[model samples]
Target: MDFSRTHFELFGLPTAYALDRDKLDAAYRELQNAVHPDRFAAQPESEQRVAMQWATQVNEAYQTLKHPVNRGVYLLRLQGIDTLDASNTKMSPAFLMQQMEWRESIEDARAGKSVTALDALSDELRAAHRRIEAQLAELIDAARDFAAASEAVRQLRFMDKLIAEVGDVYEELES
Candidate 1:
């Protein structure tokens, strides 16, 4: 009910990368009902405007939290870590090497036209993603380890890009 509260506080969600979709949806509906501009139709123009702003904020928060990647980035931002910032693009060498290896393997698989190879890589990446998700939950929810979570977020971004590229390779083969 407090307009000044952040999205996590408003929805009573733990400040973590993993969220319960059901709870988020329920809280969003509740907030929409409370601050919907239509509910303030008889109020002054200023109050109605405020309601509109609150509604917009609530919607945006819901959108951001609903997606895993966006939620991770938002959690990083809350911790004052901007992963997308150019000047903040600092990652460990081992992580960078892993990214290079994945990209190379993807290229090799595509060039060989090996569907099995591509599928294997996809499965491997998905497994890695699962581990990353569990790590995010532990780091953010249990330990409050923003530093560790930020590292995982960086790696997850690479995995996400690699997975999308795999999809493109499959589409190319299909066509």
Candidate 2:
């Protein structure tokens, strides 16, 4: 259990976008069992504190590796790239136009209180999200193109927020 290891290394997995969820889950459980604070309760105070730290690190690593978007961003970070930095806000014009269209559809659906329209939009957005995920897998795993993967991750971030908004709309409609 090396505290300095990256999330992938911590999980004993390859540092690639495509990962096996079952293996990750197994590794997480194994690490958690080893570093759980309760395992050190009978030890000295210093040992307990160290166990707590390891527990925290393992939990954080698990979370980062569990999500596809986070995994992609973390992979880029390992290569000295920061995808969330403010200075990296360059998106393609075609994508910007698509965003505008999606926003307009969302606004229209909300204004009309059209559940059907919202449902259709949600399906479309979900399909888009799936397509982006496939692209990310290719860029990060097959191509090993971090530069393009960063852009895909940014696009994914947008889709995530939009999906959340769609969920909000669904809740509003239900109420």
Candidate 3:
């Protein structure tokens, strides 16, 4: 229960992008059970405070490891790379064009109140997300190319926002 341990170490997981979700879930549950503050209800104030701190750390580490994007960012941070750096915002023109097309599609579908088109766009974005995730795994785990991985992470983050906007449009159309 060393606080200095990385999230992967805390979950007894490998320091890589590809992960076993079930293993992470199990480890999180086990750690939560061990450090749950309620178990220290009868302890001294100092012990209770320590339990609270451990619980918070365990929860934070579990969250960071649970999601693919957060996990990727954590991996990059561990290697001294900042994925959110402003200078890293530069993307290829082709990707920028693709992003614009997706935005236009969302706008058109929303304006038309076309649920079918929105669903199709959502499916396409999901496929793109999967492909990018595989790329992230390769760059981070197999290639060990943190620099390229950081760019891929930025792309993923953009995809996430686009996906969210699609969802927002769906909600608007629903109304």
Please give, for residues 1-175, the per-residue lDDT of candidate 2 as tens digits.
Answer: 5778888888899988889999999999999999999999999999999999999999999999888789889999998989999999989899989988998988888889999999999999999998999999999889989899999999999998898898898888789
List runs of model 1 lying over 4 Å from the truth.
33-48
- Local distance difference test, per candidate? 0.85, 0.91, 0.92
Q: Which stretches of candidate 3 lie over 4 Å from their true place?
A: none
**Candidate 1's residue-wise lDDT over 1-175, tens digit each?**
5777767888999876778889999999999999999999999999999999999999999988886777888888888888677676668898789778889988998899888889999999888887888888788888989888887877788788889999999888788
**What lDDT does model 2 reach?**
0.91
In model 2, where is the ten-residue run with the lowest total lDDT? 1-10
TM-score, prediction 1: 0.80
Position 18, candidate 2: lDDT: 84
- Candidate 1 backbone clash number: 0
* Worst window of 10 by summed lDDT in candidate 3: 84-93
User: Per-candidate TM vs. native?
Assistant: 0.80, 0.95, 0.97
Q: After superposition, how far is residue 7 of candidate 1 from its true place, in Å?
A: 1.4
Candidate 2 is scored at a TM of: 0.95
Whole-model lDDT, candidate 3? 0.92
Per-residue error (Å), model 3, residue 72: 1.0
How far is each candidate from the true structure, as Cα RMSD in Å?
Answer: 2.7, 1.1, 0.8
